[model samples]
Target: MSNTRPSLTLTLLQAREAAMAFFRPLLNQHGLTEQQWRIVRILRQQGELESHQLARQACILKPSMTGVLGRLERDGLVRRWKSPQDQRRVYVNLTEKGQQCFVSMSDGMESNYQKIQAQFGEEKLQQLLGLLNELKQVKP
Candidate 1:
């Protein structure tokens, strides 16, 4: 049989799964799904953002984000309001509870990150992040 080339998409997915394995338990323990965690993380870093902006930054679709935001709101982890300047736009921000959750989990997350970094080597991990960020800017 002829040799086949390695697939970039598959390799990237494998890397993501490997990374997620380290943090999934932490997320599960906190009663958060991956998508919910992403939303919280983004909101913690970015403060208030329009729903569309949150969806874009979190890499979640608007439709999925609607349901995720609803659940987050119901859990008291997030709050949303219609924009005063534009009634059609909805903005989302984390509540104090969400901030506390992030703060509480950040140490463990950082520890897991350090463990992953140690396993991957700091320089290689930095290079991988740089490459991935560069890939984000590339237009199809």
Candidate 2:
């Protein structure tokens, strides 16, 4: 039998889990799921975005995005409205509460990032990020 080792996909996922371990506690303290945090972060950085755009950026499926948005809206963290130009299109933005939440969590997030950088080395982290970005461009 041929020797079997961990596949690249499995290795990547393990690495992701390892990295998230450092930040998951902070996210939990803020009562945010990974997906919720991703949405909030993107909205904070990109301002208002269409529902589809938010989903695409967050790498969430359309159906799952609806539920996530519902929770955020219920929590008063986000507000959604239909576009005036195209009622079929929906836009989402952070509420004042959401902005506050992001600001409050920013420090903790930065601290966790620093811990990761210190443990993993900043140069290697940047190189890994660059490689991951390049990997995204790979076609099947």
Candidate 3:
């Protein structure tokens, strides 16, 4: 048998899963999927954005985004409206309920993050984040 290197893609996926494990329970408790949580988080930080921009920032495909947004809108956690300037474009923003939901979850999220930093070591986690950001810049 020969020594073989692990696949980078697999390693990254594993790391993501491991990291998400910490936050998954919190998200589940709030009845949110990862994609849904991502959109909520982005909207909270970015204010109103076009549907396309939200899809891009959330790394969600346009087709899937429609359903996700539909559900969010249906739940009254978010609101969407056709752009006044461009009927073809739609804008999305969190409703007051959505803001409350985020506020409710933030403390748990922050606690989990602090736990990760403590267990992983703040310096190591920072270094890992820096490396990951650098890797994201690499173009294939």
What lDDT score is found at residue 138 in candidate 1?
Answer: 92
Q: What would the per-residue lDDT of candidate 1 be over residues 34-83, giving only the tens digit for each residue?
A: 99999999999999999999999999999999999999999999999997
The alpha-carbon deviation from the true structure for residue 65 of candidate 3, after best TM-score superposition, in angstroms, is: 0.5
Candidate 2 local lDDT, 1-140, one digit each (tens):
99998699999999999999989999999999999999999999999999999999999999999999999999999999998999999999999999999999999999999999999999999999999999999999
Q: What residue runs in model 2 are displaced by over 4 Å at the alpha carbon? A: none
Poorest 10 consecutive residues of model 1 by lDDT?
83-92
Q: What overall lDDT goes with each candidate model?
A: 0.96, 0.97, 0.97
Question: In the order shown, what is each candidate's alpha-carbon RMSD?
Answer: 1.2, 1.1, 1.3
How many clashing residue pairs are found in candidate 2?
0
- Residue-wise C-alpha lDDT for candidate 3, range 1-140, written one tens digit per residue: 98899899999999999999999999999999999999999999999999999999999999999999999999999999997888999999999999999999999999999999999999999999999999989997
What's model 2's overall lDDT? 0.97
Give the range of the ten consecutive residues with the poorest summed lDDT in model 3: 77-86
